[model samples]
Target: MKKATRLLTPALGVGLVFGAMGVSAQSETVTVESGDTYWGIAQGFDGVTTEDLVEANEYNPRAIPIGAEIKIPDGETSSDNDVVTHVIQPGNTLTNIAAVYDGVTVDDLFRLNPGIDPYSLTVGSEIVVVDYNSEFGEDYLYHTVQPGNTFNEIASVYDGVTVDDLLEANPNEDPYELTIGSRIVIPLN
Candidate 1:
């Protein structure tokens, strides 16, 4: 296979507010690899999700050419820090905040910002965010088990990630019996 060419495109309507999760709205290009898909390519990012890919590339989300290069409009992933803080705003809600970014949820927001009183949030209070789009610059993701959470379920949350991939990332543990609150590593593939 030829080397993956890097190109940048912040094509129309793909921009998002960085304040949502501190993700810059700049887009970059990635050369498609064998077996690559929108969902699979999104696994490498925290902010730029598969949905964003469809919107940014202005193509059908379900169909993308493997050898074609596409733009990724997620700002820089991370230089070192794995998390970003979102300052609580007046009338802000975790659910709303999570909706502003792709591949993240209110539960994820809660998980990263522990002990946050959702109802009593101050306008300027800061909360950590585990934005998936930003994880591209990082190495792995940490998933805290909740009641009834399975590897399949967690993998489902992150587009194109599978139980087998998760298992490969964590070889010493039992996927069926994951302990609650225990950390599970989602390694880069």
Candidate 2:
């Protein structure tokens, strides 16, 4: 099997920010997932040192329990909504961001924000880090299927949608055996 590539730099300021928790929008709250370590989290963000992770008592570098929503600092710029934006730094891309946030896809993020130019991403342009409670209408409901695509690949194109969702919606059609030039329905919130 191929090894996973590194995504973002890590930060010591790990914390939680959920709705009704009164946490600001600039931060995020993430449950400690399997394979997460202090060193690993720190390496996900930029300029976060090992010593800083040691200082943040909330995060257990060695072993963090599942379902524990730890605070992830340095996400947003303001405190109105929780969707934080981060400028694309050197070596940053949609692929890297999606890798960092499990279940998120490059197309999912790009579709969420039409303002961004995916093909010509600027080095310092800001991109939304977290897209909570996003709108679902014309942009979210439709999808143009590309060549050599499966229902799973098409489903993974959007963040919230899953292969099961596609299967459920298109009960008659087999996702695996799909035509090359067909329009696929995108499950959206």
Kindly list the per-residue Cα lDDT of model 1 for residues 1-189, writing each as its tens digit.
234344443534434443344434444577776766665666666655444454345333334567677776553443323444555667778876665433457787776777878788788776665534443336777776666999999998886688998898666457877644344677655
lDDT of 2 by residue, 1-189 (tens): 112332353332554333235444344344566766544564565554232333333333445676565544452323433243555667777887555432356776787667766667788676765454363334446454455788878777789889888876555455766533234557665
Error of 2 at 49 (Å): 19
Error of 1 at 175 (Å): 21
Query: Which lDDT values do the candidates have, in the order given?
Result: 0.60, 0.53
True lDDT of residue 23, candidate 1: 39
Question: What is the TM-score (0 to 1) of candidate 2?
Answer: 0.33
